[model samples]
Target: MSSTPPVPPVVEGGPAGSAPGGSQSGHAEHKFEKWQMKKIPTMWSRTWAHRGKISFGLFLAYSGVNIYYARKQQVIRDTIPQNTILHWRITDGSIVETDTDKGYFQKILRATGGDSPSPVSSLIDVITTIKRAKDDPRIVGIMANFSTANNKTQQTKTLGLAQIQELRSAIQEFKEAKAKALGGEDKVSLIAYTDSFDNQTQYYLASAFDKVYMQPSGSIPLVGLSSTVPFFKTLLGRFGIQVRAEARREYKSMVSPFTETELPPPQKQNLFDLLKGLNSQILADIAKSRQRALGSDPVEKLNHLIQVGPFMGSEAKDEGLVDGLLYKRDCGKLVESNGAFGLAHYMRVTAKEHTNKLAKTGEPSLVVGIVYLIGGIKRGGGDFGANTVVKGIREAANDPTVDAVVLRIDSGGGDVVASDTIGDAIRWCQDEKKKPVVVSFGNTSASGGYFVSTHAKAIIAQPTTITGSIGVASLRPYFTPEFFKLIGVSVEQFFTGSSDTSLLHDLEGAALTRYKRQIDATYSDFIKRVADGRKMTIEQVENVAGGRVMNGKEALKAGLVDKLGGLSYAVRLAGDYGLEVHKNAGHLSSDMEIENIVVKVFPTPKPYLQQIVESMVGDEAVDMYVRDKIHSMIMRVWTGDMMGLLHEVGLSESSFQNAPVSERILDTLDTELNPDNSDIPDTVEVDEFDEIVSGVESVKSLEHDCDIRALCIVGYTRRKSQSNNCCMRGVEDRRLRMLFEQM
Candidate 1:
C-alpha cells in the first residue's frame, strides 16, 4: 500500500511530466508502472557462452553498481541538515506493524558490509518518529503525504481505516505534547498533502493534520465502507469438489463458501455491522477535525459533504474540505525554513531508530522490549511461525534489561491452536516474569489476533482498527464418494480403536450434536479469555461474540480494548509501566538516570529448508506468499477453525494477480521469504485427539542454514573465524582479495 519515492532532486518545475497548469482529460489517465532495469548485459559476458563465466562477470558488475549507489545514498543521508521538514509519504510497506525484522538478512548484510536499503518502515518506527518530533526543537514539522502513486493505481489504497486511526493518534499525541511545550503560544505544524483521496482511510488520515492540501485536479472519493464475501459453493458443485463442514454458531460463516451459495442472515448482519461501524467512526472523526477547522457548525458541513462525495479538488476546496489545491512539490516551500528532507533519509541520519544516543555516556537505562505479532497466525509456517513468535517472547521477557514488553499486533487471526499458544506465551511472560505486558493493535486485529492479546495488562487500538471477532470454528472437510469418483481417484478407509468413526466424516445427527458441544466449549473458553482480560461478564462477551467484528471505538466501548491509540501510545505506556516496576522495586529515585531502551523480538525464523524438502520444490511458490497463505487455508479445511483461517487470508488475494504480493510485503525480509520457509511447516498434528489444539514443533536442518552468501560468494565459511571473506573481521575473502587489492 506504500511506496518509497526515491530521494528525487527538487526541480523548479511541477511534478515530473505535469505542466505548471496541467489539465485533465475528464480525469487523469492511469498507467501501470512496473519497475524496469535501465541497463542490459552485453559485451564480454555475452561473448563467453559459458554460464559460469557469465555469472561471475555479472556479479562483479552488480557489486560495483550496488556499492556506488549505496555510497551515494549514504552520502546524501549524511549531509541532511537539522531543523529540516521531513516529507513522510505513506506506503503499505511502511503502514504495517510487522512482528519481526529481517534479522537473518540484516546479519548477512552487516557482515558483508553490503547494503539492504529497505524503503518500507514499520508502523512503530513512524509513530516513534512523530512522537519524538514533538520534543526535538531542531525538527520543524511533518508533511504527511497521501499521494504517493504511479499513473495507474494509488499504492496507498491499502491504507485502511485502522492505519489512519493509528496515524491520527500519533499526530494528536505530537500536537498535544507540542502544545504543552509552547505554553499555548504557537503550534508545531502537521500538514497533510495529497494529489487525490480515493480511499476513505486516506481522507481520515489527512483530516488529523492542522491543514489539508490537494492537487488542483485531485478528487476525494469519500464513499462509505463495504465488504465482499464471495461464496464458492456453486463453483465447487460444478467442479464436483463437495465440501461439507459445520460452524459453532449462526455467525461463524467462514465455511459458507463450501456449503451455501447465498449469504446467511447471521453472516450478512456480521458483515454489515462491521462495515457500518467503520463508516460511523470515519464520519465522526472527520466531523470532529472539520469542526476544529471551521469556527461554526463544521460537523454539519462534513455530514453534508459526505452525503455528496467524490468531490473534485475545486469543489472540495470550495466546500472547505481541503485548505488549498497545489502540487506536492509546491508544499515543500511551505515548510522549508532552514532545510528539508524525506523522513526515510532523516531516519537514516538519526540511526533509523529512536534512541537516547545523544545522552551523556554511561547513563543508567530502563529497557523495554517490543515484540511484534504480525501477519496471520500459524503453527510454524507462513510469516508468523508459532515457534518463532514464542521464542521471541520468552527471550524478551527473560532478558534482565527488558523491564516491560510491548506486543504490537497487526494480524487478522488464523490457526486457533497457534493463536492460543501465543496467548499462553503472553500470559507466561507476564505472570512468570515481572514484566508488564501491553498489546497494541494495528490495522486489522480480529479473531486469533484478539485471542493472543486477551491476556495483556493493557491493549491499545486505533479508533478504526478491526477487532473483536470473538468466535471459533471447526471446518473439517467431508468428501463424498461421487466427488472422489469424478477425480478418477479412490481412497479406502480402515479404522481401529473407537467404534464412533462417523464424526471424522461429516456433521449429522448424534455426530453433529457432539461436534456442536465441542465447538461450544472452545467458544466458551475464548469468551472467558476475552471477558477476563477486558474485565467484562460472560454475558457481555457473548452478546458481542457471534463472529462480529468491531472498530476500535466500538471495541473500547465494549471494554475489549483499554485505550484508543496507536503503537506510540502503547510504547509510552510500556515505558511508564516499566518505570513503575522499577519504582515499586525501590530502584528508582527522582534524579536517577533512567533511559528506556527499545529492542525488537525476532530471534530467528523457525524451520524453512525442511518445508522446501517436504514440498520437494525450489523457488516456485517463493513469489506466492499470499497464494500460499490462502492455499494453506484451503488445505487446512479438514482442521476446522475456518473463521479464524480466513480473517487475514484476504490480504494476500488482492495483489496476487499482478505478482507475488507476499514477496513484496516481506521485502528484504529473508530474500523472498526463502522458498525454504514456505508456510504450514511439515505437519500440523492434533495432539491427544485435541482437534482444537494442534501442535507444530520446530524443525531445523543443514539446508535451512543456506543463505545468500553461500550462493553468491565463492569462498565462504559456515563457522565463525578470526579471518573470513567479504573483509569481515578485518579480513577479506580470497576471491575479493584477488579481484581487488582491498575489499
Candidate 2:
C-alpha cells in the first residue's frame, strides 16, 4: 500500500563498461565524496561551535539598553531647570515622620501607581527640600497646594494641627535662610494655594505664608474650635448593660462617657481649659502672621473675624485673611511663570548634590538616630508598640554608629504598664548605653505617651501639641443575663466553685475594693515616675497630674516639658548633647565644628523582598485577613450585617481612631480577665504586695498590658497553705483559675 523509493547498492567498480583503470578511478572518486561529506558541518554543529559569539551579542544588546536609560536619567539629574517653583501637593496621608519606614508592598503599590500614591511626603522630605532650596539658585519659589491636605472623608489620614505647625516652622526656616542669603528682605515667595479653607486649622497653616490665594468659588470657614463628648450610659442602660469603672482622680474623664449621663463638673472644666488654652494659641499665631496686614490690633481683628463668619473668597481677600482670589490654574501660572517642577522631581534631581557631601573627607560628622513612635502606645508590634519602640531604642543603643537617639512621638496614650516598659527601655538606652535620648512630641502625646518620654534627656513639643494627662483609669463592662432573657435568649451559669469572675457578672465586695487599690498603686507609681524624671517634688507633679491635658506651652511652664519647639530643634539639641559628651571625653576640640549631622532612623527599614513576603504572610496580614473574615462570618450569622459588629463588641469606629487610648485598652483588658481556656495551673506564687510578679512575667505582650496587680490577687488571703474551710477552698480554686487565665 506504500509508494517507496529503493536505495542504489554500492558496487566495487564502475558498473558494466569497465576498464581496470576506470574502476580504480571510480573507487577513488567514491572515497573522495565520503571525505567531503565528513568535512561539511550541519546547522546544529555550526551553532555549537560559535556559542560564545551569540552570548556576547546578547550581552552587548542588554548593556546598550541599560546605558541608554542610565545616560537619560543622568542628564535629568545634571540639568534641573533654573528659576523653578517647587510644587508641593500636600494631600491626604501625605505627611509622615519618615517615608522610608513604609513596608515593601506599600512601596511597590506606590511605585506602580496602582493605588495612586497619596501625595505622601515625610516631614524630613519637606523640611530638607525647603532647606536645600533656600540656598539653591535655581529654586525661586515654593507653591504649596493644600486642597487635599485635610480630607474630611478620610479623617484618619488627615493632617493634624501640630503637623501644620511643623510645616509652618519649616517655611519660617526657609524665610530666614532666604533673608540671610540675600542679606536683605526675602525675595523668594512662599505661596499657598487651595480651593478652599474648610476650618481654622487649614487657615492657620495658610496664614504662615507670604501670599495665600484661594479659588473664587471657595469659602474660608475660619470658625473657632469646640469640644464634644457623647455619653453612652443611658443608651447602654436600655439594653441592661452596666459599666463598673474607677479613676485615680476626678479629672480622668476617660470613664465619664460610660459612668455618667452627662459631663461631670470636673470634666467640663477640664475640656473648657483645654479649649481656652488652644484658642489662645490660635489667636496668637494668626495675629503674629497677619500683624502687618491687620495694621493695629491684629488679635482683636482676628477674634472679630473668627466670630463674625466663614467668608467667601472675595470677602476673605477683603478682610485680609487671603491675599487674593484666583482659580487653581491661574494661581499656578502666577507662581510658575518662570519654570516649575514637583517637590519630588526637584529632590530627585538634587539628590546627588546632597549625597556627595556624605563622601567628603576630613568632615566632622555626628550621627543621630531617629525613631518614630506615632500612634496609641500599646504592646506587641505596630506603629506605636511598646515592644517595637523598645526595639528601635535598643537598636540605636547597640549600634556604635548611632551616637544619640531622637524619639518622635505622636500619640494619645494607651497602656500605662506598656508605657512604663518603653520608659524603662529609654532609661536603659541613656544610662546603661551612654546614649542621649531626646523626645520630640507631635500632635497628641499625652498620658502613656508622656510616660514613655519621662526618662529622655530632653523633651520638645510644638506649641500646639496636646500633652500632659498624668492619671490612670480602668473600665470593665458587665452584661446582665436579664437582657438576654428579654431578647428570648436565656443564659445559665454552671460553676464548680463559690465565686465566678466572668465579665457577665459585676465585680462587687472584695473584688471592687481590690480594683480601687490597684488604681491607687498605679497612680502613685505614675506620680513617682514623673517626680523623679522631671526633677520635681511630689506636690509639683501632683499639681500637673490628675489627668489634666495641657498644650505644649502650658506644659513647659508647668515643668512637664523641657522646651517648646519642633522635631528640628530636638534633633539639633540631641546633636549638641552628643557633641558635649564627646567634648567632656576629650574627643572633640573646642574649635572643631560639626560639618554634618547625619540622622539615621531606627529601626532600619526592612528589605523590599521581605516586605513583599510579610505583606502576604506576616502577622499583621494574617490578623487583618483572618480576623476580618471571622468577624464578617459572625456578623452575618447574627445580624446579617458586618457594619455594627464593632459596636456590638463594645467598640465603635471612633473608639478605635479618636477615643482616649485607655478606652480601647480597657475593652481589651476586660476580655483577658476571664478566658475560656481551662488548662490553667492550680497554684501560683504571689509577691510581697500579694501581687503575682511571676505571673506578670509569664504574660506575653498583649495589645496592651493589663493592670495585673489587682487582677492577680488570689482568693485565699494570698497564702501558700491549703484552705481548710470548704467554701474558702472553693473560692481559692476559682480565683486561682481566674489569675492564670488572665495571663
Candidate 3:
C-alpha cells in the first residue's frame, strides 16, 4: 500500500516498472527455477544408483563365468576314465614330462600362476602314475602324444640327439615291460602328432611311432637339406658397426654370421658335404617307411612337388608323406573310438589303472639308471643344465641297486665351468661306483654337451645328429659412451689393484690381450678334457677343436661316437651292464627304494588386508612393472646386436613376450649393483655357509691336496676379514678373496 502511493511510470522495455515484455521475462524465470528444483535431485539420484548396480552386475557376471568354467573343467576331469590315453605335451626349454596325476596338478598350478615345480619332479610324477596304471587290471592300452622336436633351439639350447634317443629308449622299455605283464599282448600303442617334419632329428622320432599323423593343412617340408649363414659385414658397413672376430681353425664358422657377407669357400664345402650325407639319410628313412626304392634322386622328386604348389592334406597322404590327414579333434576321437570307451572317459579310467601298474612292479633288481641331459648346459641345477645332470649321476652312483648308468645328452653347450663339472661327475660315477655309462645322442650334442658325453663308456648317435664344436668364444657389447650421450647416465670406478674393474669396460689393448689369454687358457682346458675323455692325444683333439660342425656319420668316423643307434641302444647297453653286475654278485635284495618323494605341501596362511594391499602397491608392483620394462629394453638391445639398423628402423622380427619373474629379479639385482648408485644394499647377512661348505668339498674332490690347502687358507682369510668387519660380506668379497689366496 505504501509503495502504491509512490506509483511510478512504466517504460517500454526498461526494468520491473517496464511494460509487457519485462513482466513476461520475470514470469519465465520463476517457471524455470521451479522446473530445475523438481528435476535436479531426482536425475542425480537415479544416475548414481544405476551406475552402482551396473558395476555390481558386471562383477557378478565375471565371477559367474569363472565359477562356471572351473566347475565344468572339474566335471570333465572327474568323468574321464583312468589309464586311458596319456597326452605328452612337449614344451621347449623347461619341458616337464607331465603324464601323471601329480604332474598334471603341478602343470595346472604353473599354468594358473603358482610356484613352478622342477622338471624332474614332473617327470617322476608321470613315471609313477604310468607304473601304477600298468599294474591295474582295468587298464587296456597306453598311448602317447609326442610334439617335441630336438632341433628347436631354446634359451637353454637345443636338445642333444643323445637325450632324445634315451627318452625314446626309456618309453620303449616301459612299453615292453607293460606288454609282458599283460600276457605278452601288445596293449601299448605309440602315436606321434606334428604339423610337419623337416629336420632329421624330428623325422627319426616320428619313424619310431607305430603311426604318425599330420594335419591336413600342413605340409611335410621334406626338402633335402641346407645350412646357410649370411655374413653381414657388408650390411653393417653402412651403419658403422664394425665386428672384430678371431678363430683358431679354418673350419670354425661360428663368427661367419657376423663377419662375412656369405659363406666362405671352406664353409660352403663343409655344408655341401653335410647336406649330401643328411639328404641320403632322410631319403633312406622315407624309402623304408613308404616301401619305395627312392635313392639320391628323391631330392629331385621333392623339388618337383614343391615347384608345383603347396600340397594340401589329402595331397600329402597321396604323396606318401603322411599316413593320413586328420584334424586334432578327429585324431582324439579316433583314439577314443578304437577303445571300448570315449577319449575323455578313457583318460579318466586308465589314469588310475596305469598308476597302480607302475607302483606294483618297481625298478628291476639290478637298476639301470638313465640320466637325461637335455637343453643348454647352464651352470645351475634343475632341468637340462650341467648341474642337474651331474647331480643325477651322483645320485645314481650312490644307489647300490643302480649297477649301470645311461646319459642321454641333447645340447649345444653353454658355460665352460658347467661342462667341466658334468664331465667330472661322469668320471666320478665311472671310477667310484664302477658303473658302466653309455651315452646316446638325440639331435645336437656339440661343445659342452659333447664334453660331458665323451666320458661315457659307449657313445651312440643318430645319422643326422650334429656333434663336435670344440671351441670357446664370448661377446659383450659396451654402451658406456652411447648411454652417457643419449641419457644423462654416468659411471665412474675406483680401483686399488691392477685389472680392477677392467671387465666392466670395453675390450681394448691390454684388456683385450688379457681376455684373449683367458679364452686361450679355457680352450686349452677344453681340449685337454676332451682328450682325456676320448682317450686321444691333445693334438688329435685340437684337429677337431676349432669349432668344427660334424654330422653323425662324420662324427662316428672321427671316433667321436661308437654306434649308430638311438636311446634304446644306450639303455640296452646299460641293461647289459646291470645284468653283468648282478651275475657277478652272490645274491640281490628283492626290495628296493624305487622312488624318492621330494615334493612337500603345506597350507598357505591367509594374507592380511594390509599385506595384500602392500603387495599390490609396493615393491612387488614396482618390481613387476620395472622388470617387464627392463626385459623389453634388453631384448631391444639384443635385437640391435642381431639385426643392427634393421631393428632400429622396426624391420626385424624381434618380440618381448610376457616378462618372467626371474628376469625381473635379475634386473633388480643389476639396478642395485649399478656403479652410479652410492647406496648399495648390503647382501652380507645372507646365510651362504652351506654353499661355501659345498664349494670347498667339491674343490677338494676335483683338485690335489695342495689346491685344497690353498682353498682352505683363502677361506680362513675371508672368515677373518668378515669377523673383523662385523658387517656381512657378499659374493664379491668371497670371490675376490678366493682368487687372491687360492685357485
- Highest lDDT scorer: 2
RMSD of each: 23.0, 15.6, 19.9
lDDT of model 3 at position 389: 67
- Model 3, 443-555: lDDT tens digits are 77888888777778888887778888877765543444544545566767677776423533566898778767887888777788778778999888887767777888888
Model 1 Cα displacement at 172 (Å)?
3.1
* Among all candidates shown, the one with the greatest TM-score: 2
Ranking by lDDT: 2, 1, 3
Between candidates 1 and 3, which one is better according to lDDT?
1
* Candidate lDDT values, in order: 0.65, 0.73, 0.57
Model 1 spans with C-alpha error above 4 angstroms:
1-83, 99-118, 150-157, 176-189, 241-243, 292-295, 335-338, 351-361, 485-492, 496-505, 531-537, 589-597, 604-743
Candidate 2 per-residue C-alpha lDDT over 593-701 given as tens digits, one digit per residue, 9 for 90 to 100 = 6847777888766555445555668756744443344444432343332123344344444643454443433333323322463323334332122223322424523
Worst 10 residues of 3 by lDDT: 597-606
Count backbone clashes in candidate 3: 40
Estimated TM-score for each candidate: 0.65, 0.75, 0.54
lDDT of 1 by residue, 1-743 (tens): 99998875543644665544454432343221111222224443456558787789899899999999999988876675666666787743445565232444433433453233225566666766676677766666678877653213212226556666777877877777766765551556678998887666778788888889999989988767766778887776765656656565677777777788877887887778877777777777787777755548775666677788888999888877889999977987787674667777666566543444636455556667777777888886444577667767876875767888888787888888999888988898888687889998888898889999988989999877888878887666555666778788877767785324542255668866787787888888898888898888989888888777788888888888999877777877888888887787888874454555564555434344323322433223532432344444433432342232223343222332233423322332222223375431222121221221111101112332322221111111111121222122111222122222211
Indicate the TM-score of model 3.
0.54
**Segments in model 2 whose C-alpha atoms lie over 4 Å from true places:** 1-59, 62-66, 108-118, 150-156, 183-186, 349-351, 493-501, 616-743
Evaluated at residue 7, the lDDT of candidate 2 is 57
